[model samples]
Target: MKRTVLLLVLLMAAGTASAQVPSPSQPPTPPPMPTPRGEVLYSCPGGIDFASTFSNDGELATLRMPGQPDIELSRAPSGSGFAYSDSYYELRGRGREATLTAAGRSMRCHAAGRPGEPPRTYAGGTLTVTLFPDGTFRLRDRREGAAEPVLDVGQWAQEVEGGVRMVLRGIDNSRRAFRELSVDKLVADDGTELRRTEKTDPIDGKFRLAGMYRDAQDGGLFTACLVGRTYGVAPGGAEPELEKAWVEATPSREASLYVEIIGGFDNNNSITVDRFLTLKRDGACPALVFRGSALRDTEWRLVELDGTRPTFTEWRRRPLMRLDDAGRFTASTGCNTLAGDFVLDPDGLRFVPGPMTLMACPPTEAEIEKSFVEALTAVRTAQISGTTLDLIDATGKRRMRLEARGR
Candidate 1:
């Protein structure tokens, strides 16, 4: 009887505990997966490339490619395609094959390469070979103009797109005598045989010079473009010294090229060609950046010297200096007129004032003019920023400050 009573009490207690417990709740649903989106680089098997971000579903936006501006693209009215003006792009075969003509030329392209794909990253992939009629060729970074060629030389080719030559005369006077680089023997100073592009763009019909470049050893770069068949090179930081230099390019790829050079140099005038490549292309050409002389045609009036304001007793005049492209300087001190011969270069400025007028003047004014001429001779360098120019020495110490007139 006691055992039966205990069992009944335990069952009652279990039932009460079960009733007090709360029921379990269902798990929250996970957020829907983000729409698949990625960057797509559309290319003409061998011609040009266009980049865009796409929503795998259908839409593509931000088409950035060379030879054209950034074009915004949307899904086509019918199937999997996009359009901009007369340029219609039909991306099929999962982006492996497509047709687009925004580059002003219709092209049927394939996935040449992607941004992160090791084979198609910057400075990688199929080497672009540009040949010249003179049996010369350049290894370009890309297909179009504006890319500075990595290497340019007159070549004796063992093989090319089906042609052979010992020496070339692409231009009437284009070849350099006694210099022939075997197509196979071309290499960097450290000697690395460059590889060619693994695949060619289907639209890669011709190559042009358009791009920016710099030598790994140099401090800056230059922008090269062929503006209207006129090849040009514009420097970035310090101006370059160009002598007996001109570039020549052709309308046909591997047919003719603008053969010129953009490389690294130092104070001693030695060239080290390294890290030279091109990318920014314009209309298949280059623009020349030839800064003949900085001081030429520049006119200035002294504002302050050695931190003292101009002070003259009776007859006073503000010192004026004008330099012409021919390396001649004409100046007038507050009291006297002076002429001089001078040289201005990356080195330093040296003014050798020649004969001066001996016109008499007030004692204070004469003293001012004498010291003014002396200051001009001390200019070793110049710090020109817009309208203000500070003449500095080798130590970068400011000696005279002048203001540009009528800039």
Candidate 2:
């Protein structure tokens, strides 16, 4: 009788548990969906229109073009507005304006639509620009005959807070080189011109130069890479910090360092280093940086060979080496052109010389060319940093140094 009573109590407890549980028709709640970020279509030079999709945090932009791969650019530092960059491209924008620097080409772009902004005419300095709400623009050269308007139709975008930038598209990309206009003045449709009330700042007569600085016996000598000119430093004209910076940048005596300074040229064509702006330990020229050349498929000119500087020749026809993705390379030996194959593995890099041209050259040129070819064969590894490519021998010594000059 007691065992039966215990069995009935256990059955009653199981029935109470089943009643307390929720029904099968009720399901658990799910998470909320993420809100979508906006997208913008931009019209660029050469009729290249692209679309940029932004992330929710505004830290990433994915660019999409018709025939090209999608590029993901991360947010980079900018003085105003936004900037994004990857290894190959740089995109900058403010308001509805965007500009892309890719493949050694700069193209200005504007977003497709602006709802509140209507078609406005801006005229200044014999040029008239009409910007429409659809982001298309028409620019006319008023300097010519009044009977005909030389129209340049393309895209327009907001450059800054109060400025609008218009880019001209050329037929066959002829006039597309650096052809842009920034209009700050507004001309009403009724022909009334509106100018800014604020006075512009006066221009400063100072100039800035950045290049390699060598502490020579006479004084400090600088080679401006962009202009490819050498200038002597004015004695006692530099700030005390400039000397300190040079000493800090150079680890040993007779070392060449990179420096940037601001000054004006004196009567003797020497620059006075009035202000020291920057000092990098080993920095490449700004020209090469702006060229945007990568390691592979880039033509690199031999600047230093076997711990000696190469003789100056024709600037454009200097000895260069080009490495392709197919493990093949072609190089100019200052006398003969050589074609070769190379190997790149995790262990190191090696070059195997193949066919070469046998050209008669002067004694000095022939000797230099012979040494260059031998140096290539001796290269055991390669190192690339910034705009420089250094070839090293088995002894870990740098045998040759090259700078990226593009194709």
lDDT of 2 at 395: 90
lDDT of 1: 0.40
User: Positional deviation of 255 in candidate 2, in angstroms?
Assistant: 42
lDDT of 1 by residue, 1-407 (tens): 32233234223323201122221432122222122145544333333434455655646655544223334566555333233232343333222334454223344433322222222101223343433321123333443564544333222121111111122212222332211133232333233334333443222222322333322222322222321111123343222322111112222221222222434333332233332232222223322211111233444668887778775443227776776546677877876677768775435567888767666766767677877877878877665443356777555667788764321
User: Residue 31 of model 1: what lDDT?
Assistant: 24
lDDT of each: 0.40, 0.57
| Model 1: residues with Cα > 4 Å off, grouped in runs | 1-294, 311-316
Error of 2 at 167 (Å): 36
